[model samples]
Target: MSSVRLLIGTRKGAFILTSDGTRKHWDVSGPQFAGWELYHLKGSPADPNRLYASQTSSWFGQVIQRSDDGGKTWNPPGTKPEDLMGPDGMPKGESNMFLYDTSAETGKPLTTHQHYDGTQRPWEFKRVWHLEPSMTDPDTVYAGVEDAALFRSTDGGKTWRELAGLRSAKGHLWQPGAGGMCLHTVMLDPGNSQRIFVAISAAGVFRTDDGGRTWRPVNRGLKSQYELPDPDADVGHCVHRIAMHPSRPNVLFMQKHWDVMRSDDGGESWHEVSGNLPTDFGFPIAVHAHQPETVYVVPIKSDSEHFPPDGKLRVYRSKTGGHEWEALTKGLPQRDCYVNVLRDAMAVDSLDPCGLYFGTTGGQVYASADGGDSWAPIVRDLPAVLSVEVQTLP
Candidate 1:
């Protein structure tokens, strides 16, 4: 029988949950790097057993760990890659490296951010918000980081080098959102290896046509009153998350700071699909693995108050893409449930009668074995849940 593994990343550590196809009783194993923040954990699609995790800390900075036998064991890549740069352009002289092009087109070092005091601060590598493994190669993976840059690890997460073109494309226009300019969502087009989509909070959406070499802002129709002075500005919209079904790669769905949107023409343009959703101010948007038109979003009350509407935990599903929605609340709490779901907390597995999974800030991970008809908590009472990824094992 086939089985499933839920790779859960939390504020404190990482956990692994396993179950058979039934997905009823589960075996939970972890708190893996106890006391460290595991921002994201994802398995390579080409090799299910190979996994990568983004581990970070205030004192230790960032570390990338890999596991070959699922989550049973983990180790830093055997070779030590040099550090790219410190918080500033100065060298930290540490190992486990990140390499970004030092010299800019103008013969000056890259300037990534501006501080509150109006000082120009060089881009600092904070943490990896998302990790995307190549669909065809297990050893190739991509990392999206804070201070807004993209890095790739070709040796199975052992080493990384920034795709510096993304920083050069519109680096000056990119400003930090309240969340500090993190690239939280990375999507790969399975049909076109050259196409990639990424969402950065307070920076809108960007797409690369020729892989990661060059990128352009794709916020044509997005309107943000809170962050952008001009409603139709080139960039500077707070896009919470974006999702796409593998079968229909061009069609995209977005969960913005205040609205749910859809892009039909490969993100060259977009339109609001908020529909009848009570409040589209939520994080995390996902698509059913088998049903391309079916989508899911968890609607929170507002940006200031990151809780479900009316204290009701509901997973809104749209069977016709968007413009219409139905609430799924069979087993969820209806009152006093103020937990918020992070942008990377929701995921769907490619199983028959597809399974949906999401983690909450309240330290609970919920699962719906039969899509969103009904649901149950797989585990509860850990650190705040940051991300949830699922792998189907043959």
Candidate 2:
């Protein structure tokens, strides 16, 4: 059997964790792009050997890097398809920048418009919120940006085409909450390349079955915590992360802002699964690749404080369709724990029994070999992790 490799993206850099699929011992490498903010890291399904990382720097702006030799070395794409230019050598008018304002200051725009000037250096590129490789064609890729724009690439990362269908008709009506309405998650159905699912912050979820030709809101049965009166109102919910079952195409799960929901009919509707979960305030949700009935979530205190419940770190698992929950932290930190796992920081393996992986704001990576029954810290003392993914080598 091939060894399992874990790719971790953090605020400080990127890390790789490899194991022999037997012991507690793990080999860790880097802080790749050291001191840079690594937001998302993924391995291309089209080419498992190829790895992609989305990074941003206070001085360098946003960029995506690819590595062929695992995590040993990485190189930025020669030409970022998302950075398209017009005939006059100026970047496309759609090119824009987003500035996140998390301070108490009010009346300030959460993001501002930034235009591309010829005087700017070539290395400066647009931010990538989500990156997806076409399942039908390896040369094609898709990227979603913070401006809520969708971009498509036919020649890998060398060129791009903007898909204007995702922009809201009532532009600027959507406001950024705590995390903003960025398109952070894009789910592509493996069975049909034309069908796609995207998760947004304030706007909820969207579905495009005709390969982005047309889009519709799939936020039915979801809750919008920002709204008064009925917080569990459908169609306006704030969704953090979405996970689809690998074997069952019709089953999917979502980690919402105030509740955990599962849809058995491919996201057309949903039902609350938060009855057994500790709290609905968590960010990420991970479903087992082999077991469609099993799902995992890390719950934290949902209030403004946003800390681990009971000041303890735990991973909760539901084996019977969210009817009940069990704590999966055996060897993890027991006391005074305040680490919070974000929306994209948790993942599960493709192997049988399925290994589970999750990263935290405390800069630690936890792994479980026998499902979510037990856990251990594989890597520590790194930057705050934003996302984690696992791939089994052939």
Candidate 3:
């Protein structure tokens, strides 16, 4: 029988939830790195026992850590967050260099970039927003950080180097969204290792055919009417989150600031498929494990109101990919529920019937073992869940 593991990152710390194939009773472990912000946690697809984490602090800065024994223990190749600085104020170690820049400055941006209205703003490394382990390399992982930059760590989070070439994709014009300019989504093409896609707030989506060496903006069809002088501009859309089916790498689904979009040509272009959704403004999106045509999204009221529409918590499912959607509300709260789901908070596991899971800001982690036909909470209280990822074990 297969087993399952749920790696949950929360605002206060991290937790590991385990269950067998049946996924009925679960075993919960830890508030690891307690009192710290566990922005993201992900396991290597090539070696499930190997895991990586991004831990951030308001006073200590950011540090990357790794675990070799399936969450039993963790100690990445980097220095401790509290130890990033030395007693004499000199640079201490490798993790201090921060993302692509690699400068000695540990916390803030040194240079400035063009903002949305063509204003200059310093890039901020607030935290690592997402961690994507290479599907085939256990030691190779990708980290997407705030203020929008991509970094790769091939030595199991021991060291990181920024993919400086990403700047060629008109990065100067990229601006921060309400949550800061974060390269929050990094989707690897299952069929093409050399091709990579990344999404940035206020900068739209960019794709690279030659790994991370070169990138080009693929936002030709993305339209952002708000916060831009030209809604038709090619590089200022605030893409909330993007999802790609493992079998169909070229096909993409997006939960934009206000519209649900689909890209049939590998993000070369896009078209809105909001269809019958109550409100298109929301975060987080996922593709079903076996059905590429099926997708999921949680509909929030609007960008201004970051809660479910009509005070109801509902997960919308689309069997036809985009234009068509139905609310999955069997075990969900339908009244006065206003919890918001973040971009990295929803995921699907590749089980026989497949399974769907998501975490909400109200400290609730819900699961659906038989797809989205029904729902149940694995845990009702945790520190405002930040991100959720699932792994299926043999």
Candidate 4:
């Protein structure tokens, strides 16, 4: 029997939940590195024992911490891979410099931001959208930020470089949304490491077949926010999340602000899979590791209310590629439950029977071992959870 370890990243810190494969009993620990907004956590696919956490603070900005001896103790690197330039270092012809200056001049200090500090404030570090390990090389890693940029690290998390492809697109620099041009999700194809897929908020989806050397918007068949929209408009669509099936390379699913879409042709084209899904207005979508047609989603009321559906909590599962849906809430809460699950909160494991997990804004973590037929609360009474990940140890 294999034991499972769950890493829960929350608004205040992180919690490690260990359970027997049955998930019958759980041992939870932490508030690990308190005062930091833990956004993303993942264990190295090649080395299950090593862990990486993306943390942000109001005073310290953003930092990635690593733990080799499980979650026993964490070590923050002396210098972060990504660098934030001071106002004096702003280059000429940079339009964003003004916004950066205004933010620095008025909004406390840059170090108080998410990527800089581990503190939480109403307005700091918009979000750390995605953390990905390099499929081609385990030592390499990538992180996407709300500022609509990609940070790459070749030496695990020791050093970093910003990908110029996104920052300096041809003819025009990508404009920032309310949270700036945030790159929430970065999808890398394991088959072809050079081919990359990135989803940007308010910028639709982009694909680069030439290894980030170039990128093109692949938002065909996707809806736009504008009332009158171009059928082929590649920009202006807000994508909440994107998921790829590990077994099938071509099949992909996306949770959009307006619809759920499926692409059998590797994101070149898409069709609405939102048929049985609640309302086409939620963030985050998880796919089963072995079953490409099976996926999970937690729907909420739109951006305004953004609470559980009808103020009720439910997890919808679509087994036939979104052709139909089923709600799974066996052990979940009922009545006066208004917790909201974010774009990165829900996750699935690659176990044989498959493990389903999701974290809530109410500071709780739920796991279901037999798919979504039933569920159990593994960890409770923590900060607002931003993301959840599970890794099997040797």
Q: What is the Cα root-mean-square deviation between model 1 and the actual structure?
A: 3.7
Q: Candidate 1, overall lDDT?
A: 0.87
In candidate 4, clashing pairs total 18
For residues 249-320, what per-residue lDDT tens digits would candidate 2 score against the true structure?
A: 677888887788888887898888987767877889988878888888888898476778888898888888
lDDT of 1 by residue, 1-394 (tens): 8899999999999999999999999999998999999999999999898899999998888888888898888877643335345568675433256655676652135566544444556877778889999999999999999978788878777667787777765666677777788989899999999999988877789999998887888999999876567888888788999999998899999999999999998899999999999998999999999999999999999988999988999999999999899999988888999999999999998889899999999999999999999999998787999999999999
Q: How many backbone clashes does candidate 3 have?
A: 1
The residue ranges of model 2 lying beyond 4 angstroms of the native Cα positions read 79-126, 168-172, 225-235
Please provide, for model 4 over 147-239, each residue's C-alpha lDDT reduced to its tens digit, 9 standing for 90 to 100: 665667676666555554553332132344444557888888878878888887766788878877567777788875552156446565777
Off by over 4 Å in 1: 79-95, 104-110, 114-120
In terms of lDDT, the poorest run of 10 residues in model 1 is 106-115
> Which ranges in model 3 have alpha carbons more than 4 Å from their true place?
78-92, 102-111, 116-118
Q: Local distance difference test, per candidate?
A: 0.87, 0.72, 0.87, 0.73
**Candidate rank order under lDDT:** 3, 1, 4, 2
TM-scores of the candidates are 0.94, 0.85, 0.93, 0.84
Q: Return the clash pairs for model 1, or none.
A: none
